[model samples]
Target: MMRWRSRSVSFFALVILVGGCTAAHSGEPSSEQPAAADVVKVSTPDTSPRPNDPGLDAKLAPVVSSAVALAEIPAAVVFVVTPSGSWAEAYGTRAFAGTDPVTVDDRFRVGSVTKTMVATVVLQLVEQGKLSLSDKVSKFYPEFPDGEEITIEQLLDMRSGLFSYTEDVSFNETLDDNPGYVWKPAELLAIATSHSPYFEPGNGFRYSNTNTVLVASIAQQVTGETLGDLLQERIFEPLGLHETSFPADGDHTMPVPSPRGYLYGTNVSALQTVQLPDAQLQAARTGALFPHDVTELDPSWIWAAGGVISTAADLATYARALVDGHLLTHEIDRLRIESLGQLDETNPATIRYGLGWMSFGPMIGHDGAIPGFQTFMGREPASGTTIVVFCTMRDSPTGVRPANEIAKNVFRALHEN
Candidate 1:
C-alpha cells in the first residue's frame, strides 16, 4: 500500500529502478520469468461481475477514460464499491504493443500491496503469541546492523534505519542487466547493510525494503515456514481470496490469465530532470532509461515486498478486510494507528502511513509499480467504499501516476456526487 507515498516506483526505489524494478525489490524479477497465464491458474475470476452498473459505471467510466487519455497509459482494469453499489470495468489493451483488450478479471501485480498482507500475517502471529512487536531483531537475526536497537515494530513501520538495497545503483544496474537473476534474500540484505543507516532506529522515517525483507526473514525464522504458506493458511484461504498468490521463492511466476507487464521509461528527457539520490544510480538510470518489456523477469527480487499478482475484485475484498480489521482483534487492529506519519504534510488527507499500510483519508490500501504494470487500491470503512486500479503501463505524460490519479478521481467522484 505504499502508493500512499510513491505510486510510481512501488516505494522508495522507483527512482532507483533501471526501467523501474518490482515494487517488491528495487524491481528485479527474472527476465526468464513465467507469466501468470503460463503458471498454475488462480481460481478463475468469478464470472458474476456484470458488464457494468448503470449508476456507477456510467459516471465513473468517463472520468476513468479521461484519466487513461491524460495519463497517456494503456489498458486499465478498475473496481470500485460505494454505498450505492459496486462495479468493475476495463479499458485499453492487455499489452502495450498489442490489440488484446483488458478485462476486470485480468490479473495484475498488486506490488507493495503484499506488505499489507504480510503485516496482517505478522499481526496474526502476534495474536497467537508466536512473536511480539516489541521483540528485537537481535532475537532473530542479530547479525543485522543495529539489530539490538531495532524492534519488530520499527521494522513494520520502516523506522529501522536500514538502507533499502533496491536503491543501490549497482543493484538496479545488475537487475537491469539480468532480470532473470535469482536473487537471495541474504544478498539483498548484504547490499542494504553495506551502507550506513539513514538515522538511529526510530529516530526518523524513511521507507526501505530492507525492513520488510528482514521482517519476512524473521517471520520465517520464528515459524520455520515460507511467508507464502503463512499467508495462504492464515489470510488467503480464510478470506476466500482465491486469486492471490505470492510468487515462488527465487522466481517470478504469477497465476494464469495475467496481462503482460510493461515498463514505460522512454522519456529520457523527463528522467534527466529527476534528481536521483545517488550519483551512481543516476548514471545507471541514465544508461537504461527507455521503454522495456519486462513481462518475463524473475519475481524473486520482489518477494515479500511487492511481488504479488491479483485481480481487481480480489484486491477490493482484501482492501475492505484490512480496513474493517477482519483478520485482527479489534484491539490489535487499533495498533495500526499507534505511530502514524503523513505521506505528504501539505495534503494530510491524502495519506497516512503506519505499520505496513497506507491510509488515504478514510480509505486504506497501497499502490505499486513494476516494469510492466502499476496498481492502486483504497477502501473507505465508513461507507464500504473501495477503489482499485490497474494499468498495463506505469506513469503518465505529465508524470502523474495513473493508478493513484484514477483512484483519486474515483474517490472524488463518489464524494462530490
Candidate 2:
C-alpha cells in the first residue's frame, strides 16, 4: 500500500477538472514516455514557483547530492510541494557508469505507489455503482478460488488473502529466464490461483500483489477496457500527469532520458556483481551492491500492483491532487481514509494501511521496490505539501530510508525555516 501508456482512452472523456495545483518545475523533460537514445532534456523555471523560499533550490540540491554518496544510492530526485507552488530537483549520475548525470526529467519505476491510483479508480467505480466495497469477487469471476467469499473492499485493503504471485519461486525463475516476457494480467493471476489461498478470503491482512491484479482485471471487466485505458481516462489525464504511464506487456523502455536501474542484496537475478575482494556483505549475504541493469526488462510481472512508470514531477502534482480528493466526492474519500488498519502492533507511528496507501504519521505515502528502483511519495495535507523521492537502486545498506531522509530534509528546509 502506498502506490499506463497503452490503449488510447481519451483523458477528457470526463469534464475538465481544474484546481490551483502547480505543474512540476524541472529543466528536463518529465514525460514518462522515453525518447530514443536517452537524450537529456531540461526546463528551468523562469520565475520560481513559490514554496516559501527563494534559495530553496540551493539548500535542496546539497541534500540530494549528499544523499547519493551518504546513502550509497545510484542517484536521487526529490520533489517538494507547498500550497503556493512546487518544484523538483535531482542529483547524482543517471547511470552507474560514466558521467551520465541524472536530470529532473528522468523517470523511474514507482513500485507500490501504483496501488493508490488503482484504488482511486476502484473507488470511482464504487461511487458509480459499477462496483461496491461489499461486492463479492464471485460477482466478477466466480471461477477464482474462494471468489464467493472475497469482497472488493478486502482486495483494496490488502486483506484479500490471495498469495502474491511474485513470491512464487516459479514466477521468479521465469523472470530470470526471460526478462523480456510480456505478461498479461490474467496470466500473472494464474500463477497465484495455482496456489491455494494464503488464508480464507478476508481472514487476515497480508500485502499481496495478487489482490491488486484482481482489482485491475475487475476494473477492465467493468469498464470494458484495459486497466491502462481506465487509468488514462480517469486519473492521468484528469490530473495532467503527462510524465506518468502504465507500461503494459510489450513496453520495455524507461521514461525518455532515463538512467540504468540497479539492484543490490540479490543473488538469483541477472544483475552485475560489484563484489569487493574482501567484501563485508551487508545484511543477508545476498551479495552486497550487486549492480543489475533491469531498466529494460519487461515489468508486466508486477502489473497493477507495481507497474506504473512515473517521474518525480508527475508524482508531486499527482500526490497533492490525489490526497485532495479532486476526482471523487468527500463521502467516498473519507470512507477510504477511515479504512486504515494498523500494520505495526507495538510501534505503529505512521505505519498504517488504508484503501491503497500506508501512512507514516501525518504524511500519507507509500514506498516501493522492484529489481532496480526504490521509490517513496508522501503528502502532508495540513501544510499543503507533497514530497517524492526516487533512487535507482531497490535497496542499500541503508535500506529504503535514504529517500525518506531526503524528504525529511526537504520538509525541514521548507517548513522549519
Candidate 3:
C-alpha cells in the first residue's frame, strides 16, 4: 500500500512525531533466545466500564476534532487503551454530506495493515517447519531476477528490492479507468516484474507491495490454500476477530455498518502529487467541493498486500496479540521484536521497521493507506497500551496521512497525561 516514490513526505511527518524513541536494534530470529517477560496474555475487549483518567478525554477530543477538520476527512474513529484506562471516540459523519455520525464499531478497509496478518501466517509456517526465512525466492518462482539471492526475511522486512506494482504508471491508470477490475495475484506480480528491480535484492530497503504479494503467494504455495483461508484458520479464528475479513476476489462490497470511503483526487493525480491545486484546496476546505465516495472500488488490486476489512475493536485486539506473543511462540515473538531496524539510518529518531510491523515511540504496529481509507494501529508492549485510528479519507489535500496525524497527536496527549 506504500507508494515508494512518493512516500518521503508522509514518512518525514512520521519521523518527526516518533523520532524520540530508542535507537534501532539489530538481530536475527534465533530459537535459542530466552523468552522475554514483556509478553502478555491476550484478552478480548471488556464491555464493562474500566478505570479511566478524567483528563484524557479533555486532551484527546480536540486533537481528533481539529485533525479531522483540518484534513477534510469525512469520518474517523480513535481508540486508545492505556494502563490508566481506555477511551474510544468517533467523529464526523458516515458520508461526505450525510448527517449520520460514524460509530467506533464501523468497519474500514485497513489497507496495508493486512500485511501484518499475512506475515503472521508466514511466521507460523516457519514455526511449523514448513518454511524458512533463509529460503530463496527462486525456490518457488525461478524466473525472478536474483530470486536466488532474495530471502523470505527480506520480503517480510521491506528489504526486497522488487519494484512495487502500485507505482507502475499503467497500474494506476488501470485503477482509474477500471475501478471494478478484479485483479489476480499473478497479474500483480507480472506488472512488478515487468520493470527492473529498484536494487539488487537484500542490498537496500524499499517499501514495495510486490514483496508482500510474493510472501502471500509463497504461503499459499506451501500450504496449498488461499491466503484468505489461511488467515481465517490461523489468525481470525484463534484471536476471535469476528469483525475482520479478507474479501474474496470480485467482491467489492463492504459489510453493513461501514461508512463510505472518500477520495479527493484520482489515482493518477495522487500518484503524481498528493497536493491539490490551490483553488481546489480552498473549495474543499469550505465544503464547496466534496470528495468522491469510492467505497465500492474493487480491492482485489491490492490482494494479500492491502485488502483486509476490520473495525477499530478488532484492530485493537489484533494489534495487542501481534506484539504480545499471543499469535506466535514466545521465541519467535522475541525475534520479531528484536528484528527492528531504523528505516533511515541517518535519522536516529526514525521509525523502525521490523518483521511486517513498525515501532514508533513506545508503540509497535503498522499504518496503512489506500485510495479512500487510511488506518493506524499500534500497541506499547510493556504497558499494554493500544491505539487504533481509522479515517474515511485516504489523505489530506496537503498529502498528510490523516489517521497517522491524529494517532501521533493522540500519542503525544497520552504521554503528557
lDDT tens readout by residue for model 2, 184-212: 66666666766666777767888999888
TM-score of 2: 0.79
Task: Point out where model 3 deviates above 4 Å.
Answer: 1-53, 342-349
Off by over 4 Å in 1: 1-48, 266-290, 341-349
**Could you tell me every candidate's TM-score relative to the true structure?**
0.81, 0.79, 0.86
Model 3: worst 10 consecutive residues (lDDT sum) = 20-29
Residue lDDT tens for model 3, 273-355:
88779999889888888887888889989988899999888888898778877888888888898888433322212477889
In model 3, what lDDT does residue 177 have? 87
lDDT string for model 1 (52-154, tens) is: 6788877887888787776656578878876667788788876664788888888888778888888877877787687899999767653445677889898
Evaluated against the true structure, the overall lDDT of model 3 is: 0.79
Q: lDDT, candidate 3, residue 64?
A: 68
Q: Which numbered prediction scores highest in lDDT against the true structure? A: 3
